[model samples]
Target: MNTRQLLCALTVCSTLASTAALAGNAPLQQVQKKWAECQYSTPDGDEKEQCFQHAITRIGSYLDKEPGNPELTVWLAINKASLAGAQGGLGALSLAEEAKSLLEGVIETSPQTLDGSAYTSLGSLYYKVPGWPISFGDDDKAEEMLKKALEINPAGIDPNYFYGDFLAEEGRDKEAKVYLTRAMQASPRPDRPLADKGRKRDIEATLGKLK
Candidate 1:
């Protein structure tokens, strides 16, 4: 099999392993760490696309087979959105909407203690998707989603970094500074240093533009 197919297969196996382990009393974080490793192992573009697709199938199956599995539903939606850029066209748009709906449902149903991953995933989807004024790429929605994610998990670097970019793009340099600074400080792991560096670049660029 090609790289994409291999990554997809690995993604499916990891997802199944994670869910089964979750069901058997293993720590959720440990399972998630392995999932993150699989995600990072795949290169961007097609390989990543296949990984997300496999994630959809595995997580979606869990959601359907296991009634009242709120967390799995959130994960399914989260991964569905992950393939947006690779999928492209109308199909991508539909998948994005599907992800958004599931995330919204999770927020509505789990209110006080919804999963932080859902918020970050939704933030990512809105932040990346491009469209006309009323359709997609809503800075307002992106801001709300990222902010909600950060509120849920103060140490989350992704939300802060992305929000910083959004604010910088919207000409909110001063405000963006705070988030970018926080993002640099909230780096989730040493291996993923670009997130912090990219946000720092945005911060500097925004400052330059403002000056």
Candidate 2:
């Protein structure tokens, strides 16, 4: 090939490589945005359940391509947890269990990924699910994981909010108020307006319960 033709081909290849790298995480971000929409914007009902189901399928496809990626795995877990909430029955238990397993795997392999989101999510499952013969819920484990998450991302909204909710559930109203207030005052996430709004509303409701 001529020198000029070789140079043009090299430039094309470089541009394509750059473009591919830039878009590498685009699918992950899209899944995250869709999850926020499903969790925060969709009302609790069959429609919400369907939304989560679709998200699970999409994330599953991404996982098939990226396999064992902490970010995708965590989102897959998050979607399953949300689906469990929307399902809310014996069937929900299995989804929650799956989510718990996925989050545990992420924590074991990449504890610091997504700013300790795996810890936050695992802690949430620990407290929210049933216990004993029913499921694996354990308040003490929940506290430990949530506290670890807080240590990693002290000002993060999800960790603070989940920890506050756990505290509220444990009847530590004053402590719950402290964390919930911090969560409410947290800086808004540029890409997560719906989640921020919904979480603040939740904090307000939880605070009202203390009053």
Candidate 3:
């Protein structure tokens, strides 16, 4: 995949994995389910954009009620990133910037929240977005954030999968396969069947590419 396609794929994958962190919160769980449907089940087009927009609105209402909640804030960021991937263009960069800001806030206040999901999401954004004049994509920063996420959640599916994908993107196939394998073996989240299933597919697809 080229840069733009890789960016969108990684963006969408990171969004799916991050939702697992919110499984314990009932309202957030609803949002997570809706996101899975919109991302994996819905066809890519105007319809998918509307689905994400509705999800963004729902997440916004929850954020308004629990302004101090890191989990809710992370979900808001995740949905916004997903929307940005769906609506690719000049406007997409603005949405991605907003998402980055939200995730950074969570990292500042609650880096350990949701098993360091903010770090994983932020890492994915850093590596996937363009660098310099276009956006803030930085390999060094991405590696740092992703490694920090792994330090916090060594056995988590999202961190492993994201780190693996990052490595693969950088042409480090052997190291990437190791992390992808670990991601596949991650303990299932009982409350997040859809997210788990979807993540498994992502892991498998990435693994296939390494072959």
The models' CA-based lDDT, in order, is 0.66, 0.92, 0.90
RMSD values, in order shown: 11.3, 6.5, 13.0
The total of clashing pairs for model 1 equals 0
Write the residue-wise lDDT of candidate 2 on 42-150 in tens digits.
Answer: 9899999999999999998988888899999999999999999899977799999999999989998899999999999999999999998899999999999999999
Which regions of candidate 3 are displaced past 4 Å? Answer: 1-24
Clash pairs (backbone) in predicted model 3: none
Overall local distance difference test of candidate 2 = 0.92
Candidate 3 residue-wise lDDT, 11-51, digit = tens? 99887776664554778788878988888888999999999
Where does candidate 1 stray beyond 4 Å? Answer: 1-39, 112-115, 131-134, 187-211
Q: Kindly list the per-residue Cα lDDT of model 1 for residues 3-109, writing each as its tens digit.
A: 99999999999999977866763323333443454355567777778777776666655556676566767666756665665567766887888888887787777
- State every prediction's TM-score relative to the real structure: 0.65, 0.88, 0.86
Top-lDDT structure, candidate number: 2
Query: How does model 2 score by TM-score?
Result: 0.88
